[model samples]
Target: MVLTNVEEQMSLRLAVEDFLFEESALLDDGRFREWLDLVTEDVRYVIPVQTTRERAHGSAGSTTMAHWDDDYIGLEMRILRLDTEYAWAEDPPSRLRHFVSNVRVRPGSEPDEYEVRSNVMVSRGRGDSRATDLLTAERQDVLRRTDQGFRLARRTVVLDHVVIATHNLAFFF
Candidate 1:
């Protein structure tokens, strides 16, 4: 059966949502290597540092320094390190729940690509700790359709808080 443009778009949206859900599940499950596979070889994962200034200062985020600026190779190394026993920050490993919502997907300028924006809240519980660290942010992603499936080509995370409350970033956003 032939699908209309609207129908096709709806299907695409559903596909994108499913892709995000799967990615989140992988991270929450501590499947870092598998999660890295979802990213393209030339993927760029960036988390810009946020600042607070008067209204006259204009934008709050700065390009000078990024909390995280990783290419595929860098990301792969990080994932590999996290999986090793030497990684003290996650040696015991923390329980993480990634909540992704407000997902909005639009066709990108590039062919077979989509620009997606979503709100993410990561709740992490350390071993025997009564407290849970909550990190909130908005992520802008570029997803490209590949032979395997949709792969993340770029991700820009904009954290909500000016001063991050978490002691350390042991979990993915």
Candidate 2:
């Protein structure tokens, strides 16, 4: 049976939400290798540094300055580092919880691609620490349809705070 336009849109939204939720779960579970599989070979994952600017200025984030600018290879390398003893940041491993909300999905320039926007809040608690750090951001993503499912092609995370208060940014968003 053929679905109506509204039904199709609803179905697509649910699929996108499911994909994002799964990704979050993987990160929360420290399953970096499995998360990597959800991304495309040419994936570009970036987190631009947010700046406090006047209303006259166009964007708050700098195109050049980024907390993270990674391709598939870079991401793979980072994940590999986590496995080694040299990864001091994650020696004890941080407990992470990702809260994703306000997901919006739309068609992309490519037929098999979709543009998705969402808000994310990550809570991190390190070993023997009572303090839990909270990081909030807006994420813009390009998901490409593949035989397996939707794969992340591109992602840009814009942080809410201009000055980050977290101890370290060793976790993913």
Candidate 3:
């Protein structure tokens, strides 16, 4: 049966939501390598520095200082480092959970691309540590539709907090 434009768009949106959910699951499961495959070769993942100021100042973030700004190669290096025994940050490995919600998807300039925005909350706890850190943010992502499915082309994370409350960020957001 032929689908109308609206129906098709809705289907695409739903598909993107499923893709995002799967990605979240992978992260929570500590499947870093597998999660990397869901991104494009030229993927840009960045988290800009958030600041607090008067309303007249405009936006709350500045790209000049990024918490994380990485391309495919950089991301790969980070993933590789996680495997090293000396990677103290993740030596014991922190238990993490990624909660993604409020997903919104729309068409992009490219026919096979989409612009997606979502809210994210990451909770983490290290070995023998009673304290848990919660980091919350809003992510703007560009997803490209490929033969296999949707792959992340770019991601910009804008944290809600002006000052990061987490002890260390050793895992991907």
Predicted structure with the largest TM-score when compared to the true one: 2
What tens-digit string does per-residue lDDT give for candidate 1 at 1-173? 23369988788889999999999999999999999999999999999899997999898898898888999999988888986788898878989999999998888878878899999999998889899988999999999999999999999999998898877775677
How far does residue 31 in candidate 2 sit from its true spot (Å)? 0.4
The pairs that clash in candidate 3 are none
lDDT of 3 by residue, 77-168 (tens): 99999889878988788899889999888778788888899999999998898999999999999999899999999999989988787777
Q: Where is model 3 more than 4 Å wrong at Cα? A: 1-4
Task: Show the colliding residue pairs in model 1.
Answer: none
For 1-173, candidate 2 gives per-residue lDDT tens digits of 23369989999999999999999999999999999999999999999999988989888998889999999999999999999999999989999999999999989988899999999999999999899999999999999999999999999999998899887788888
User: lDDT values of the candidates?
Assistant: 0.90, 0.94, 0.89
Residue-pair clashes per prediction, in order, are: 0, 0, 0
RMSD of each: 2.5, 2.2, 2.4
Q: How accurate is candidate 3 locally (lDDT)?
A: 0.89
Candidate closest to the true structure, highest lDDT: 2
TM-score of each: 0.94, 0.97, 0.94
